[model samples]
Target chain A: MSLSVRKIVISGILGAISILLGVTRLGFIPVPTPAGHATIMHIPVILGGVLEGPVVGLITGAIFGLFSFLQPGAPFFADPLVSVLPRLFIGIVAYLIYVSTKNINNILALVLAGAFGSATNTALVLGMVTLRGYLPFEVSLSIGILHGVPELIVAAILTVILVKGIQRIRTSEDRPPVS
Target chain B: MELTRNITLGVYLPGETAIHRLDPRTKIIAATMLITLLLFIKSYEAYGFFLIFTAGIIVFAGIPLSYALCGLKPMLPVLLLMWIFQFFLYSTPDANILFSWWIFTATDAGLHMGNIITLRVLFLFTVTTILTLTTSIVNLTDGLESLLKPLRKIGLPSQELVMTMIIALRFVLILAEELDKIIKAQMARGVAFDRGSFIQKTRKLFPVFLPLFINAFKRAEELIVAMEARSYSGGKGRTKMKTLHMGRVDLGAGLIMLLFTILMIYIIISAAPQI
Candidate 1:
């Protein structure tokens, strides 16, 4: 397969995963917070960055953002700035993090990339929401702490495990058997 | 775990009504116009007209009202919560107090805000749902691609983007089925997914998602290879198997939409804005 087609297909798959996560409500883990659910929707965007490149991540994140905007559960996410722009950064930042530390430790790199990606989503979304006067700064901060921290932790763990597993599969598939 | 069954977003129901026969672009443009009008709509009178218009379309499109509204069932809690928040939080200086409880106060203006916003959301959902219901996915794609073709001059890969969106939408159901299988497999292995506390349930999801994602990547890789083997290149120099045409029905639909737009504008101008 050509490289561009491969990237498009991979990104499309990741975007599909992101949308399916929201549509099926499987990605939303209910928590006792104002938002009621902590989402793993951004994880696929992070994974797209780690597996493919920043471009794929950006497209996947944009797709995820579009879905959230169309099917916004909260009023804040109905705005494209709050829903879409933050997500556009997820893949770029995650890819940068992964590349910087990839040689030293792949697993740690994945975890950090995942955490940073999730943190990017939380910080930018809430920051935009507060900036737009959707919610008070203190209220946004409290909700961020309540929902964002756990989401970051989950993203870190999942990103590490999934990247490791996929890497193993790719490497093994690339290897040839002894004669 | 039958989450896939509840999804009605992309599922197309075939019909032979004139509404269904209207050009996809016409439906798309009309829905957009209605949604734009919905945003500026304030008074109950406007919403009353909006409801009648939507109901007429629903009937004309041959879509069952219940089926059209089934998607809203899942969103009721969120909508209700939003209504409650607006009822207690939204008010103006001249508003009369309806009730007061501790730190929260409900006002007459708050009630109107709550009602208007909730109705707006409901109308928005209905409009989109109607568009999707009346237009099939293939037509929807073609219409969107044609509409967005103007951006190609700016170096935007509009066709490729639309292709990606179509593929992603197709996979929503496929992945949901995959999730169901993974969840069932985990259950077979004695993971009581339904019996756990919220955190415990969420933690259990890691195992399911890990496998699902791994398999998804594998599927994507295979799909890429399959497309490459078929010599499939995106968007560039692609010819349509069926080109879209605007028939007489589209012109009629366009005229009706224009009339609705004018009426909505009149109401928006004359009606008092809700505080």
Candidate 2:
């Protein structure tokens, strides 16, 4: 399968945004939890899925996952099982959710996509951490709830806002005469 | 305000040392092997050896020790927190309790796990930092593309994927500059990014992200147009301007990596599990 130029560039830029959020600590919102932050890094992956397609989302997630693995923010993320493997699903899941639910309502679809996408990251990464014996199930579950809820809320809101904003640009550019 | 100052990943420090001169493919492979080795290392002896090996590479590559470690500064808090988490939360049967506080207990098993996992993270960061520091982005792209070309047989779109990574690496600094400007602009408009309640702080980020995502998509559109105008197609019948070659330095590096790997495996096998 060949990647269109649009897919490649969008994925790349989105991945760059993910990396930037990570390195600058902007993606991590301060929270009153033991982990101290909830991440919006996967938003770019979700956006990639919602705006482009699953392939772009998958590629962006891979880059985000690679960055986390190489420059891990958390100790367990040093394990690829806990970091890279789970990230690949964020975008794909978001895409599936958005596509299936959009006919019912666009905004609701975007929110669900964002919420489920963030959930995928939290559940899978924590599950892997627990499975690999890094964190106990009790701790993982607590962190999952504390960190995951905030992440889901932020992701859901951001997904609707960013997707709408980006989609407006694409639609305008695609039909320049109307704009 | 200076968001770009602390970033060391994806930033290449030009050098003429032997380690810098080695092929990117070799460096990538060596880093991957080291990462794999780190996963199996549960004992202190193995980590000691691993630390020495990585330090030697840093010195040989002419990277100042401080500079090599400076990227780790921001992560120190998280590392300490993680260590604390493991020390208190992780426990095994037959493990002696080191200490106990109200509703909290630390055990020898927890201590060992914390130390080892923290060490693993430290080494993992160091190894990857060294690889990116020594290798230029262009060389990295070439090496990765060449290395992944074999997987094209499985219809994985290796070229396109590498192209995506290349773009990601190149755009990180660019997008960072954009993010920096966006934050500054928001701050100018009385968006106190670092203040307010939890939800309030999250609300402040909305203005920052809308413009950032919009701007990034705009750039993507321009890039797509430019590439299409230049007749860019995914990896089909593409020719390289310069082909990669594995020289004598690569062979010598390979030998060193082999010896280190064998030694590490031996250490891992013989050392008793710390827990």
Candidate 3:
């Protein structure tokens, strides 16, 4: 009962930060493609999911998606469903990957989770925006493909760092438990 | 840590206002309905009424005007970019140019487009923010799950999704608090976080995040064990401790939303099309 109360408090704080970072722009680098903008700020989200589990991760992704949908510049021009549903998918997919994996390195699980979560976010949001017919299909695909490469790479690296680092902490706490 | 400071959604500010006391499901649907109406708001007059109506809600909810608008700080840049894009790309063939520079030209139509679009995004954020600010996280989850339950027939797994959402919403503040602590702990050392080049500052973030990541994973593993101990399973057979109800508040809120949507639709037809 006490832990559940503590978890709720903790969860609220993480959700708030995710929304804040997800909304603020750190200056986007306009790419050659219509929606090309490069920013590496999604690191918190990747960490948020892997650390808090898929539930936290999904919420982070959903919040990011919601923020994007609220943007007037959104290619699909910002529908609420477009903003939210993809994020929801990102969260579920990442967690699903983590839960389904065999007992191996935690780093590997985190990597897959981050990669899948982020990729789902990018794919679903971009697909919905494209459906709005603001830009041509080929153009949107090119943009998605181009930006996806870096997003995936960063997600993979972040997963390893966060997952391994978190595992180390758990083991350290356990070390003193039996003593 | 600092990032979560701007978050106001699903916060449940603990108030005595009428909106605050409304059922969580009612507020959720009211917010959704109002936002949908907002999306179709095309006229200055309609938006004027909306602005007034939104302001009324803010006051009624006991939220300070400044407190509400302050949340837009982080979103300002994106709004500006949207406005800029509208300025350059939205001109019609016969639209009069308001300003002209190198290649980018700002037209009257484009200017209107910018205003309407920006106004829409701003209001959308505000409405949702207010909703979360009043409703508790658990109630919000229950409401969302109840609302989404119909999607189960379509293979939506709405219950599980809502559970994930509830946990996510809860974490927003926790991570922020944790982040602040970790950052301060680092600053206690010789780490000069604020006194370095942009790249250097960013690079120094590695140590801060290193600890945060480790703590987060530990929490997740702990959560997993705790769940197993409780014999927890997925959304299949799970039952709710609290059931949803549609009180008078929902009916009142629903009527208000219907009236607002009707008025907005009428104005949308009468107003000049910005697009």
Candidate 4:
């Protein structure tokens, strides 16, 4: 339907933002961690899921995953399972968390959704990396803690602020023009 | 950071070589075959052959060696780290120990593994860069759409998927430009992005991303309204203005690929693996 086209357009833009973040290295913020940088790339997928539905989130996540696979930093992400599959779930999980918690409290729902979405990416990617024997389980876990905690914090704060701003815009648009 | 200047992905360099003229599907399939071979290649001899073959392709495609490799500069640090990791961590029981340092040992096997993996990554990147450099975005979309049409039988929305991919590629540059502007505007406001401690620098980035993302979403909304105004719908019953056709050039490329694949298989079976 017409709604689907709109979804596609939004998803495409978000997907572009994800890829742009990777290409330009703008997604990487210099955090004093083992990895030296924390990525905001996954934020787009989270935003897509919150603003639209799971389908848009899934599409945007796939694009993000594909870019990661193409330009893998670690050998583990060269595998599609590590790179693509985990990303596909980011949007779906975020959407589910957001929907389940929306009635309880809006800001809390957005924060939890963002944190969980980021946590899902960290857990799944590192879990698969260890399972594949790319790095030792202990090493993977430590790296995840060092990198994931900061990423989750950033994702949660940004997602809450972004969702609130977007909602305000939508509600205002819904209102009639002031004379 | 002049990030846009360094990006080579999705930046099509127009050329008129045979590799450029071949159908995009053929190039895609060939790139896939080469990447698969890269995953299994274990011997230095095979890698030497791969280097020659890739270099030949770059020459045939008329891409300058320097231009083809400019993308690798930013990647050097990651590649070096990977090499170092493989040097200390990857080892076989029979490996000759080169050195030992506090719970870490470098071995001959680890050295070879590191070298081979780094080479694999380098060639893999070069191959993909060549593909994008020669192939225009429109041709890539059309070729991908046509190639993926068979999946439509399983109710897969391939057209919409390709459309999304194309748009994402196009926006890589656009978004980077927008990001550059945001960084400059922030700089004009006396934000010192480069002078802070690591954590402080990271925290400072929050202000930049907030506006960038908000504007991105606003642009997305405006895009949606614009598309809706144009009566845009999903890829239902949509027809292509220019349909794809396989020519004699594609046949030649296919034959060459088949021969190369067989030769690679032979080398893989015959050569001794480095590990």
Error of 2 at B135 (Å): 0.8
The deviation in Å at residue B41 for candidate 4 is: 2.3
Q: lDDT score, residue B64, model 4? A: 83
Interface RMSD after interface superposition, model 4: 2.4
Whose DockQ is greatest here?
2
Docking class of 4: medium
Comparing to the true complex, what docking class would candidate 1 get?
Answer: acceptable
Q: Please report, in order, the local distance difference test score of every candidate based on alpha carbons.
A: 0.84, 0.91, 0.65, 0.84
Candidate with better DockQ, 2 vs 3? 2
Candidate 4 lDDT, tens digit per residue, B194-250? 897866877788788777777787787888788789876556777889877889999
Give Cα distance to truth, residue B127, candidate 4, Å: 2.1
Superposed model 3: Cα runs more than 4 Å off: A1-17, A23-38, A41-60, A70-77, A80-157, A167-179, B1-5, B89-94, B192-198, B233-244, B272-274
Each candidate: how many clashes?
Answer: 0, 0, 22, 0
Q: For every model in order, what is the iRMS?
A: 3.0, 0.9, 6.6, 2.4
Give the distance in Å from residue A20's predicted Cα in candidate 4 to where it truly belongs. Answer: 1.2
Model 2 docking grade: high
The CA lDDT at B173 in model 4 is: 84
Give DockQ per model, in order: 0.49, 0.84, 0.24, 0.53
Candidate 4 segments exceeding 4 Å error: A1-3, B92-96, B271-275
In candidate 1 the C-alpha lDDT for residue B86 amounts to 67
Candidate 1 lDDT over B65-154, as tens digits, reads 888887777677867876786677766789999999998889888787778767776776788778888889899999988998887788
Give the Å shift of residue B145 in candidate 4.
Answer: 0.5
CA RMSD (A), model 3? 5.7
